[model samples]
Target: MEALNLTSSGPTTFILNGIPGLEAAHIWISIPFSVFYIISLLGNFTVLFVVAKEQTLHKPMYLLLCMLALTDIGTSTCIMPKALCMLWFGSKYITVDGCLTQMFFIYMIAIMHSAVLVTMGFDRYVAICDPLRYATILTNARIAKLGLVGLIRAVLLVLPLPLLLRRLPFCANRVIPQTYCEHMALVKMSCGDTIMNRMYGLVLTFVIMGSDLTLIGLFYGLIIRAVLRISSKKAHQKALNTCSAHICVMVITCATSLFPALTNRFGQGIAAHVHTLLANLYLLVPPMLNPIIYGVKTKELRDKVGKYTCRM
Candidate 1:
């Protein structure tokens, strides 16, 4: 990775390849990206509306679902439109400031997603293990506080990245080989020494994502134990059923994120186009699938969705 001399006096604009190593497929590629974006927006918005309108969904569990839906929307929205434009219109140039902003929101939403999932696990644990105290422990105010904490945590952690990047002299290639302005992608283009930048980003990701995963696992472990202790099969099944939708979402979210991160880092034999597709899917799949999963798996949500769709 040889560094090039700075070509201009001002900040540079990087050319984003809509689908690197697959330029000829950009037009056709935009079709699916557009479809996914539309579906994600509609699906997440519907979840928000449904959760808001249905009084039965005002409880902590459903409220957490609502938060997860919102996080999905934010995550997908940050990248999809630019990616669509690049695929369809050849609008691949992104300014440094704009790119940093996109990168910030992208990581911020991802962190919020982990936070929401962890909180959802807590909601489930309380509902199952301490049913008598669930309501008292997770009130509306506490949920709001959780959201605030997630936001603050992400902001505090990710805020330094763009600032640190901005301070670096990017006297190198101004071309990024992906559809979006990811932190690592942009860092790879810099001419200046980025040991600190790289190390901090990796450390932050491990700390936040790692802690969230551990907490989620612990909560689910407790939930599982509590469910198994139930004397009747029916009660055990009922408790597990209550947790199924959330478990599905957590699996999907973690799988999508982990696959790309691991593949990019270690799977050198994988095709670049495949990596790009996975990167795109990381943003698209969750938003599009989450509402569908909840709508199909949860009877109450399914009934409400069916009624709402029929009414509309």
Candidate 2:
């Protein structure tokens, strides 16, 4: 049915690759992927639920944690089902419209994920540098507006990508060597020159992610400066402890996301299947680990989770 719809006159469809030359092992591969996906869902959902249940946890940091969980869910949702379908059911076709829709969400989620991290960094900064003003600075309404701004930014930046991609005519090659509709993979399927598309993707990624990372770094720098000035050794250790979890999360997420993009663009000698696997890792790792890191590192959230579990 999908193959029948690849004509230029109507709509275009492309076949998704699970792994080149590893068709026989797709089912085997699905086992671990599915497990990771399930664990991520359970973990992130627990975060959302606990945050909602505990009134005391209704602070700026926890609210931002909720945003992180939401983005994690979004990242996984955009990739996992289609990936699992391709792996398990041997269904691997994505219509042009469907592919574009998926691409938009994937890009938006990534940008928003970065935004949430930066916002969390800001939360930490305010808490440390201006503890008395933290409440007034990051009010509930202000937090909501900050999230809305991030959403708007993500939409405006990602909106052009799908529009730019639509102008490319399919060159009769409908096979994309990845489970999901990655931008470069889709760009390669076009008959036209993809240099501009590649350039736009590269520039936007650097400008937005680069800007976010810079702001986050600046926030941490100020936070550290403030922390070091504190006379009490106990206060110094406490402040550093508060930031350690956020730093760990930031490092894990940024590395997983940026490395695959960089490697995809520059690492020509690498294998295609390896790139695909890395892309999947980019989507999976942040969602799977963020909750665990927070739960282990933050005592309040951890205690709430333990009590909630005992009751259940």
Candidate 3:
């Protein structure tokens, strides 16, 4: 039976890898990564600013967009700056407490991102499936409640991760083979039996992301059915267009997150640096693309951004 390798003193520090096999290219790699980081920061911030400043965007959908933008900013901030510093300055040492804190916020924002996506899906469902009651159902007070519930849910789910990780003993190598401190990466470094940690992570991913994806799919199904019932072609087109931005975000997020994770868990032949790159992309791409997607696909948002920019 596997047992906890308890010790009086736990690991004090961990060294993070910039990229598994790309140390020589860290400077070159930092260029694109830096661009993505800067764009993600500016994009997400712009989305939040536009949504907040524009009174016309005070609806539930835009409010959820604000939540997503905030989550993206939080998620990107947790990963990018540290990774950039590691690449740029060769500062790779992170204390155990700092590692755990980074893990906490990364997982927290990720869960919050999923929750926000689900809420956006729900907003779409209400908007399309029952257009008449959309206003009443997704009121500002109710959206606020939903946002609070999402925050609580994300907090509750991710709360155990760092705590559980703190209990494990690290007798093996303390170097994490990634740019950032991932929960699983930390767990993999522990000499102690980490079945519980691994199982909890797997279960959490399945329960939270699985359920959110299912709910989004179901909502879209209902939405499609509702759209099909519409008689006019223009009305049908309009209904679908409303959902295009959310669908794009949903696809990008799920693809960026799920594929790399599945490959990491199951792909035995995949390169370590490939996993690292994927993990970085999973965190980076959505935040980078989300604002552009919304700006292009969402006319109201585009118009608001245009007006906001023109006034400047």
Report, for every candidate in turn, its global Cα lDDT versus the true structure: 0.86, 0.89, 0.89
Least accurate 10 contiguous residues by lDDT in model 1: 1-10
The TM-score of candidate 2 is 0.96
Model 1 residue 295 CA deviation in Å: 1.0
- In terms of lDDT, the best-performing candidate is 2
Q: Write the per-residue lDDT of candidate 2 for residues 1-312, one digit (tens) a residue.
A: 222223367456778978877889999988888988898999999999999989999988999999999999999999999999999999998888898899999999999988989999999999899889988999988998999999999999999998888776666668889989889988877777778899999999899988999999999999988987999999999999999899999989888988899989899998888888889988998899999999999999999999999998
The reply for model 3, stretches above 4 Å from the true place, is 1-8
Tens-place lDDT digits, model 3, residues 86-110? 9999999998788889999999899
- Candidate 1 Cα errors over 4 Å, as ranges: 1-8
lDDT of 1 by residue, 1-312 (tens): 555433357455888986778999899988888888899889889989998999988877788888888998999899988988888889999987788899999998899889999998998899899989987999988998998999899898889998888767675568888999887777777878899898888888779878999999999999988887889999988999889988999899888998988787678899988988999899999889998888888898889889999997
- Ordering by lDDT: 2, 3, 1
